[model samples]
Target: MSPVFSASAEIDDGHLHVLITGEVDMATADTMFQAVLREPAERVTLDLRAVTFFDSAAIHAVVRLAQQFPGALTVLPSRQVHRVLDISGLGDQAWLRPA
Candidate 1:
């Protein structure tokens, strides 16, 4: 079966806010990544509190976006996302914040 997923993005005051729900594996990583990167913004907030799965691809996408945005990206991670990122040693990044 297909992985469940949905993503929405909005820009306000030069900040891009993206909300994502569902699985974030290879199949949906690009979708989430593109949604957050589609527009130009001075800052970005990625909300993943409803995400159920976060795989390696999702981690890669997050890393890439973090690199692209530098100190301008913030991530609100769900339990699943926090677990994966913690295990992957990326949870210590300055951009991760409690939901």
Candidate 2:
């Protein structure tokens, strides 16, 4: 079995930066969802550079996160991670920017 996903967040210069690791799937997507949205922030940056795996559920969670902050949510997705976003139509959303 895979290790449970883990995430941490910090506010830097008015932007919330969340670092995530492990697999983010149906079982763990909500954790990232709650961790990020529970706090009110003008902007959010999800650091998915360390995430080794992610599924459609994870993509949905990120879409929701994007809705919460609209144009203020930036995503730092690994090269492998970008494909999912592109397919999900999230990559086309003006609200989501890849870094």
Candidate 3:
């Protein structure tokens, strides 16, 4: 079955806090992308604490956002997501973290 992904955003300390839930894949990446794009904040923190699975497309979405926003993207990913990011060579980026 295809995994589901959902995101919610809030403003905190002058930053955008995005909490992501479920799985992240091609099916759900666009929702996440749009959510972040719509939020008006200088800093964006993505909380992947509830994300159960992440694929290359999801990783690409994040990388692309990072590239677009530069130092404005911060990721708080679960251990599995963190491993995927590390394996995908996205760990070296200044925005992703293992949570």
Candidate 4:
């Protein structure tokens, strides 16, 4: 099993930067979602480059964040994240930034 999920957030100027590491699974996706929701900003940069594991529930959390911020959301995905996004057919979403 991967390490337990962890996340941190900070705001600079009008951008909210969220960094997530460890496993993002059914047990942790909701916590990840709520962490981002707590910081409302004109722009959001989600850094998932350190994610060791990713799952469908985590994908739902990411999609919900995209819906919440739309064009203002940018995701930096790790290899794990990219694989699942590709499998889920969301790899081409406009919010994704090359990782």
Q: Score candidate 4 by lDDT.
A: 0.90
Per residue, candidate 3 scores C-alpha lDDT tens digits across 1-99 of: 744677899988769888999998988888888888886788999898788999888898888889878888899999889999888877777887756
TM-score, cand. 1: 0.94
Query: Could you tell which candidate, 1 or 2, scores higher by TM-score?
Result: 1
Residues 10-35 of candidate 4 have per-residue lDDT tens digits of 99998999999999999999998988
Alpha carbon lDDT of residue 57, candidate 4?
95
Off by over 4 Å in 3: 1-4
On lDDT, the candidate that comes out on top is: 1
Which scores greater on TM-score, model 3 or model 4? 4
Candidate 2, residues 1-99, lDDT tens digits: the string is: 865589998886778888888888998899999888766778888888777787999998987887778789888887656767787666766755563
Model 1: residues with Cα > 4 Å off, grouped in runs:
1-3
Q: What are the runs in model 4 whose C-alpha is more than 4 Å off?
A: none
* lDDT sort, best first: 1, 4, 3, 2
| Lowest-sum lDDT 10-residue window in model 1 | 1-10
lDDT of each: 0.94, 0.81, 0.85, 0.90
lDDT of 3 at 60: 83
- Tens digit of per-residue lDDT, candidate 1, span 1-99: 654799999999999999999899999999999999899999999999999999999999999999999999999999889989999999899999964
